[model samples]
Target: MPKNGAPTRTRILDAAEALVIDHGYAATSVDDVIAASASSKGAFFHHFASKQALADALVERYVAADLEMLDSGLAAARAAGPDPAVRAVAFLDHFVGLADGLMGEQSGCLYAAVLTERQLLTSQTSAPIATAIRAWRDGFAALLREALPAGSPIDVDDLADHVFVTFEGAFLLARSTEDPSHLRRQLGVLRALVETALAAGPQEERR
Candidate 1:
């Protein structure tokens, strides 16, 4: 579709995604995307209606990729262990490792960023971001449901929500403090939670 006969749309979205990851949504610009993607205005307009539309596309792509990685990691973790509780812990540990590796000393979360940057665009632009966040939360809940012991009475949905909030906060803290140990402690807390849940045995339910 581009006059240059390039993969302009993908190039633009990919460029936007990378820039948003590094500089964040509010801080990035169309010019930056153009420069990074090496596309002309004609090509950019051909793909996206506006900067907000491009951002929406980028966020959707980012969320999809992220969910895939999380799903894969959780699957790998479950596959690595026999006990359901152990598998859950392993999955949480893998998630922690992923957070450390991806963000490192960088500040901010992609989801948190989208939520925060929603003010920059109109209400219509917010739907996709909100949907992405909800999907992520639901995905986590589903993982917990799968990792729970057979006949366990624990509300997997609630537990997953708690875990998601805790994990998100821990990542934020680690980034803010530049201290990885904070995240380690948080992950330890999650492990302890899983251990406690498992301790309830086959007959007990979450309190």
Candidate 2:
């Protein structure tokens, strides 16, 4: 629906995404996005049918970028070694480093910010957000499964969910407390949990 050039659209999205991260979705208006983008009202409406349409586009763009980053980290970790357990530890190390770097720069996760406003969003606007979250969880679960020895006592799927939860919590805590070390400590706990599980070896089923 955007009548303007791709550059114009990107500009609008870029401006809008930054505002949403700093100001939450409910507080960000179309006019605000237009003003930030330095585009005319017509240009804004042309690219997006409505404010919700803009929201959907932003979520899609952010989610895609997030997945790409995660995939890159995973690939790097996998390349570090052939053993699943080793790769698993490498993945956590890579992820922790990524988190530390982002926190160091004080960059908040867009998906986490938007999720807090989900009640204000329509299904059309929220579906992509949910899908992105699921993809993240599934990706981590796959890595955990690969890393754990067969019959390991720890539940790979559950641990993956915990990883997601812990990261989100860490972000909230770090932002609220103005301390990136909160996230670092949480990642430490995550590494410890993974290491403990790996050391436990496979478990036998009880009769």
Q: Say which candidate scores most in TM-score.
A: 2
Give lDDT tens digits, candidate 2, residues 5-117: 55889999988988987889889999999998889899999999988888889888987887787787679767988887787778778877777787875456677767778
The best candidate by lDDT is: 2
Q: Candidate 2 — what's its lDDT?
A: 0.79
TM-score, model 2 to reference: 0.85
Worst 10 residues of 1 by lDDT: 100-109
Structural similarity to truth (TM-score) of each candidate: 0.70, 0.85
Error of 2 at 74 (Å): 2.0
How does model 1 score by TM-score?
A: 0.70
Number of backbone-clashing residue pairs for each candidate, in the order shown: 0, 1
Regions of candidate 2 where Cα sits further than 4 Å from its true position: 1-6, 104-106, 118-121, 202-207
Error of 1 at 43 (Å): 3.4
Residue 46 error for model 2, in Å?
A: 2.2
lDDT of 1 at 31: 89
